[model samples]
Target: MWQNEPPVAGDLPAEQGIPTLITWNHGGNVVAVEGSWDSWTSRKMLQRSGKDHSILLVLPSGIYHYKFIVDGVQRYIPSRSSFCS
Candidate 1:
């Protein structure tokens, strides 16, 4: 599950942020996530979970944009009217 919202009754204090589970279901030899959290600088690695790849991120409450790097290819979920970059 790719959750963009901050969890309620979080594991950590509100100031410290909460652990959010991010999962990538697309198949790839390598999978990672980059987002506004680090201005896309840090490519956090995701471990394989059955057929999906996932990672736990501790993020503060806010809106964030993210993309997946699958086997070195940057991918985004396209909207119905837009094409994938």
Candidate 2:
């Protein structure tokens, strides 16, 4: 599940700005959200949930590109439009 909006009442604090929660349910040992936010160099490690991995990011209002890195492998979600080069 990929949420670009902040949750009403949940684990994320309301004062932490807009929260974008990215989650992945897989058997990998590690997962991350890598994109232009970090120059596509570093990986923001996601926290482990019950049977999934997730990460909460506070981002400004705008559009951004990103992909998931699971166990050192990069995977991109297919977009309807040509957003990726």
Candidate 3:
């Protein structure tokens, strides 16, 4: 089984101009971020970092909703955001 630190709950405050790193530990072949940051039109592939998966996104300061797509199935990270059907 793959083990990784999940995304922090609530709003994520920006630091400098660096992108925010979001992670998931589903142990899937592919993982991607789908959200308002990209207008929900594309999937930003998350790289496999050790036993976890992560993506770097530089988004504007705002409440942008998002979810993860693991191997073509959508999944939600609890306490982070509601599941988008």
Candidate 4:
């Protein structure tokens, strides 16, 4: 799990065995997650994306089309300009 001990590296799951989000946004006193998974995401994260905002749904699955999400939103490519750049 951990390379050493004490404080963990960031908020990311060391194992990543259980799909989840590692980061969140702090706005208006609410801790908003960056990504959403499952059906609960609409009730949490997506609603905050702003009506003027449009998310690019990229499901680059290899086969069977199985993609994991956070809160309920699809996982994004951090290297892509549409996401982070």
Full-model lDDT for every candidate: 0.77, 0.71, 0.77, 0.32
* Candidates ranked by TM-score: 1, 3, 2, 4
Residues 1-85 of candidate 1: C-alpha lDDT, one tens digit per residue: 8889776775656577667777778688789888887687899999997899899888877767788889989887664212122
Q: Look at candidate 3 and give me any clashing residue pairs.
A: none
| Every model: Cα RMSD to truth | 11.0, 11.7, 14.0, 12.4
Please give, for residues 50-82, the per-residue lDDT of candidate 3 as tens digits.
779987777655667889999899999878773
Off by over 4 Å in 2: 1-17, 79-85
Task: Pick the TM-score winner.
Answer: 1
**Candidate 1 residue spans exceeding 4 A from truth:** 1-14, 79-85
- Write candidate 2's Cα lDDT for 1-85 as tens digits: 9889866577665563457776777557788878776577878998987779988788655566888888899866565111222
- Kindly provide the TM-score of model 3 when superposed on the true structure, using C-alpha atoms: 0.68
The sequence of per-residue lDDT tens digits that candidate 4 reaches over residues 1-85 is 6576566577656543332222322222222233323333442332334322223333222221112244444554354312221
Q: Candidate 3: which stretches are off by over 4 Å?
A: 1-18, 82-85
Report model 2's TM-score to 2 decimal places: 0.63
